[model samples]
Target: MASSTYKRYHVHGYDPRQHLEHYASDKPDMAFEEDVLKFPMENLAKTFSLGHIRGDVLIDFSASCMIHHLYAACEFFNHIIVLKVSERCIMELKKWLDMRTGAFNWGHTLKLHREIQGIGDELPDKEEKMRSAIPHVMICDLEKENMTDPIVLPPADCIISVWLLDNVCKDQDDYIRYLRKCSRLLKPGGHLILLGGLGMTYYTVGKDRFHVFTYDEAFARKALAGEGFVIDDCKVKKRTAMCDLVDYKASIFIVAHKEK
Candidate 1:
């Protein structure tokens, strides 16, 4: 109900290891690799390769300590800025970026990305690329007027947010308002890439449960349109795995452009 509640869960209870092991594990049944990771990677690669999306600076709004979704974008953009809501999340990400002792190994995710791109033979160093591309990881509050306040980041060429809005917003209206706030971080005609869980109410991490705002594809389309974004592409994947750990019905990915 309150924003503090959401922050408490993530800042205190969120475990990067548990989050990665549960969702992005090498397990076959986990739809996260195919539905969440691979789909977005391929879409970004293809878009960037075909010259559909062009940008020098790319900003990720939901960095969440996961670099799998960012592998493709690094090839096209020179500068990448990752924004997180919780300090714990920022620390987890820095652990990896700094190559600390307990950093979560993302080799499996990088391997999958290389396979999808058909670059297994001549794979670029993904970890190094990610570390070099992402120079800043700062705190951001979606409800605020300037997400990266005081710092005053330049408007990004593209913004990416995955599974962030539903977890943070209290309802659909709140979600839409947050979406508009995120859009302000982008330049006019800049792209917005979003990945979210459809029809999900809550998810479990370790022993604690967190809330999610549920909505369908229809609602997503209308919300993006209302926020002055033109939907360039949208994809939805039905859930095949039935796990009590997470109760999402489907995964939705959208690529939208802010209207000039």
Candidate 2:
């Protein structure tokens, strides 16, 4: 994979609305969205519903402005904190929190989440529940000395980071380094639930292809174990359909607890 050809996620300014429509919108022809977004929501609903990994606070460390996965999360956690690298993402998130006009509708994703849990259709009041649980959306730098910058956040009971680190890290070493950084945010024995594409090189968004840090299941396990996390559960979703816009062999979801 030529790293030069792919754009860095932090360097490019993404249209948060465009991105949501591309992957999370309810379109019949969105094959890539069907695989990439829905798979994670299914895993999260199943995993969190097991009643083992949840707490008072959960932090979101995912790429793009997607919060559909967190719909299941708000049910378990008391407060949700969103950490984003882009100002555009922060603003878009706030729009949802405030319930402004034109905010990307997460209704379809919520429907999928409810479906995965075998619950009845229609989440009442849509995302008002999730929005109520989220108290803050702050700017974070994955590479900064303090990822949250200047403000050091209180250690969280759990952190749900999906599809963020893979795009932020340039290589395997960087991946491990970022894992350690994410681990620092959790209290001792706090869980870190992560999701990412496996063996993926790049995914296109509106003519621009963004880089994906390629790694396999074994490497991910080793990295987490090396960073003081003990694996509690792991789930993999093999690629369901073939597509050129998105490339990946599988998607990995892990639930691991930090061991001091």
Candidate 3:
């Protein structure tokens, strides 16, 4: 999309309502499921299929409510890192993890094989080993320079950021820069997955306003390519259909892998 046209289409100074609270309490009705389902299962099975995740680390940035599902989906990974900037998110995941520790949250069915380690402090070897047996969750603010600051994370095999790019980038260039940083976090031949909130016009939380850009598949591909990510494969999924029945656009789901 042309920059001029893109700006014109987006409602200036739009703020999204804080839906995270609603999501934290209960899954608010949005098109996120539709978007996730839109991913071509065949391609996903090939790319993200458990067998492909050989890296020792899988970093999930701004993991929000996905910790539960991701834990179930990625069984092959030895270590799964869950990153989130929200305390509520951390609290919820911690609660879930805590329950699993004692007698297994929902019986022996909840397999606690992966560890969920928080960022910042150095964890003890024994603690790390135990946590690695369950999904690890950490509280981190990626937008802040001190913690995430782009230089803190280890070289990862796969870095996934969902519904977070639009919030960080002020414009297309900023978005591209964010993508470059994401690429840097991954090792050569690693992968990047971008998910959530694609076609939103504006979002508001409390008094905050979030400006959004409706990024299409081609636009996402171009942005990733500019960041040196060759499209190994891509599947577009709709995130939300908020407008009245007449006019609505699905959020775009993009999965782009970094190349050598």
Report the number of the highest-TM-score candidate: 2
User: What's the ranking of the predictions by lDDT, best on top?
Assistant: 2, 1, 3
lDDT accuracy of residue 175 in candidate 3:
77
Model 2 regions more than 4 Å off: none
Better of 1 and 2 by TM-score: 2
Q: Which regions of candidate 3 are displaced past 4 Å?
A: 1-32, 36-46, 100-136, 141-151, 203-210, 238-248
lDDT by residue (tens digit), candidate 3, 1-260: 32333321122322111343323223445333333332322233445554655667777774344343343335445677777666655665565556544221321111221222222233224333434644556666444543465446668787767666765566677678667767777899887877645555554444443445556666787888888887665555443434231112554445666777
Off by over 4 Å in 1: 1-13, 27-31
Candidate 3 overall Cα lDDT vs. reference? Answer: 0.51
- Local distance difference test, per candidate? 0.81, 0.85, 0.51
Superior by lDDT: candidate 1 or candidate 3 = 1
* Best-matching candidate per lDDT: 2
Query: What is the Å distance of residue 178 in model 2 from its true position?
Result: 0.6
Across residues 1-260, which tens digit of lDDT does each residue of candidate 1 receive? 34235333343548867777777777676656766677677776776677767678898877356788888888888899998888888888888999999888888888877887888857657789889999899988665688777789988899889888877877788889889988888899999998888988777677767778889999999999999999988988888666787688888889999999
lDDT, residue 204, candidate 3? 44
Candidate 3 Cα deviation (angstroms), residue 151? 8.6
Cα shift from native, residue 183, model 1 (Å): 1.1
lDDT of 3 at 55: 64
